[model samples]
Target: MTIRVVVADDQELVRSGFGMILEAQPDIEVVAEAGDGEAAVAAVREHAPDVALLDIRMPVLDGLAAARRICAGSRCKVVMLTTFDLDEYVYEALYAGASGFLLKDVRRDDLVHAVRVVAAGDALLAPAVTRRLVADLVRRRRAEAATEATPDRLAVLTAREVETLRMLARGLSNAEIATTLFVSEHTVKTHVSNVLGKLGLRDRVQAVICAYETGLVTPGAP
Candidate 1:
């Protein structure tokens, strides 16, 4: 199916450039454009696109706030990310429910790929921007344990389930986790599902964020 899209940015050139790239893709169609945050929300509700590529800084409403509003109201996947991979707005955008992010300087192929990835219901990290927040390993572990202290859904996780979750937070892909733990890929997939369900998260994006915010995974760590 064609992935319907909306490009929202205050800059005319940025919007136009994005439109051009999306328009060239057979699987992606630029359904609308919004020059500001409020208009972006309006356009998204009207067009009901499969994905909304939102810029963080826009007039009328900032992309971060707009993403929160849009994601709250729409079923569409929201990839509220940026052109500059290091743009700090990205962190807030993720907290606001962006499914994927990319730098504006990202190659055309990578840009298009990000859209497709999010549209498929996956969340993405800013490419190569793993965090460097410096709580020591012990402190980090303590923080993670604390963040999960009152998780409403932990009751649902088995001992094995929790083990799978920690490894996932460590950034191991399903295949890798499976190999490391000597399990099948299908088994890992089942554990991932239970983790999401028990944690009350929307997808892997939120899970990744939880992994970070709860101090389970530090981006820059090995």
Candidate 2:
């Protein structure tokens, strides 16, 4: 299946460069290009692309706001782009339902791989980056009463599934979780799927956020 994508950025060079890189892939197609947030959302609606690559600081709407709208209204997945790996922006983007993010200077192969990862209905945030983003979000809310992961909600998960989620929240990939649990990667994938379904999460990114928000895992806690 071809993964249709929309590349949105204020910079003409960035837009063109990404389009060129992505279109070079056999399974990936650059369906549209947008210069700002509003056009990005519009392009997604029109093209119904599998993924939307948006610059975090676009004029008119910004990536966070665009991501919220796109995730809320369409089936398209969002990948935010930025020059900085700032925790604040990443945290906000995750909460806004971004599947992941990419740096403006991303390598060609990495950029193509990110779109494929998200297009396959999986999250794509780097483990280290995700950890920092989660920690930042949790720290900002530390003063407020912690909201435990809903027990009734978690009740649907089997013990193995719960363990899978914990591993996922710890930033372990399916293969890593499989190695830790001494199971096949395919089995781990099944468990991860179960965890997402039971939690009603859109993807692994949301699952990780849910785990943190519900206090199933704590930032920097060993």
Q: Identify the leading candidate in terms of TM-score.
A: 2
Alpha-carbon RMSD, each predicted model = 3.9, 2.1
* Prediction 2 global C-alpha lDDT: 0.86
What does candidate 2's lDDT look like per residue over 53-127, in tens digits?
Answer: 999988999988999999999999999998887836777888788998888888999999999999988887464
Cα miss at 111, model 1 (Å)? 0.4
lDDT of 1 by residue, 37-123 (tens): 999999999999999988888998999899999888988888765667556666566666777566667788888888887887665
Q: What TM-score goes with each of the models?
A: 0.81, 0.91
Backbone clash pairs for candidate 1 read 83-103, 83-104
Best by lDDT: 2
Candidate 2 error regions (>4 Å): 146-153
